[model samples]
Target: MRAFPAVAGNETLRNGLPGGLYSLLSHAEQYRLLCRRPDLIAPAVDELLRFWPPVVEFRRTATRDVVLAGKEIRGGDKVVVYHASANRDESVFPDPDRLDITRAPNDHVSFGFGAHFCVGARLARIQMSALIGRVVAELPGLELASDAPPKRLVSNFQNGLKELRIRWG
Candidate 1:
């Protein structure tokens, strides 16, 4: 009973952190920036979280009747909120498709929003920051092993890599 929350949180980090790191490595320009500027690790992590969120979407039951996007959603309705799509909203993020590590005012919904927001969001950020920083410092020559794009986990629920081959000197 007591260990359930801890295990759940660990699972989230396990799934999310690697994908975030892989996302950084896939983009050559961003990876270069991380190598050059250690200070940018935090922002880079945030941008990665926004650009390639691990959890693609989550289902929630609506508690009250509400009109969203001019569509009626009644109480007890099952709604699937796509956080990844929301993070890439053109109206919200300028040049949404581009992975800008320096993106400020980055109010991304990667860790979710409002009441549904993740309780371990801060811890996740810290862990990502440390990992990115260490990888940049230690594996300066790290790069993708193949020119071909790495395979992704084929699942509607998780946005993660099946494998990300890399080599470092």
Candidate 2:
């Protein structure tokens, strides 16, 4: 029997989409802004992607020996790249922790980078933008149903919420 390989591309929709939605909805101020200005949906989606990248981290083999942050890594050493950390790097993103929907030049690595960049990145962005746009238009009154913290998916590889309780009048 031939074992089927995991369809990693689905992660963009399965994990990424929901994660982005939850991040936006949970932040009431941001949600209201998007509802008021539909034109900001695209950038808002990008910010959401950066703020909570679904693929938390990925592993790759180093091609050459190098010293990173004082640690020497030999060729072929396994290196873990944490997308979440890179997205929030203060040097790259000013006031990184705060979500700025209008942030320009948002060179976030939520979709990976270089040769390993995700092919479905454009599709992911479009999907996020469309979904967010529709939500803003149709559910302007939507809000978190509870003040309790959301239940997050317990996986080091994926950053996502298990459920986001919401209500609309």
What is the TM-score of candidate 2? 0.90
Give candidate 2 misplaced runs (Cα > 4 Å).
Answer: 1-7
Error of 2 at 114 (Å): 0.4
For model 2 the local lDDT of residue 46 reads 88
| Lowest summed lDDT window (length 10), candidate 1 | 1-10
Highest lDDT: give the candidate number. Answer: 2
| Candidate 2: RMSD to truth | 2.5
Clashing residue pair totals per candidate (backbone < 3 A): 0, 0
Local accuracy of candidate 2 as per-residue lDDT tens digits, 33-105: 9899999988998898999897889899999999998999999999999999999999999999988788887
lDDT of 1 by residue, 97-165 (tens): 999898998989988888978888998999988888999999888888876667778888778777777
lDDT value, residue 27 of candidate 2: 80
User: What local lDDT does model 2 show for residue 37?
Assistant: 93
Q: lDDT, candidate 1, residue 64? A: 100
Q: Which ranges in model 1 have alpha carbons more than 4 Å from their true place?
A: 1-7
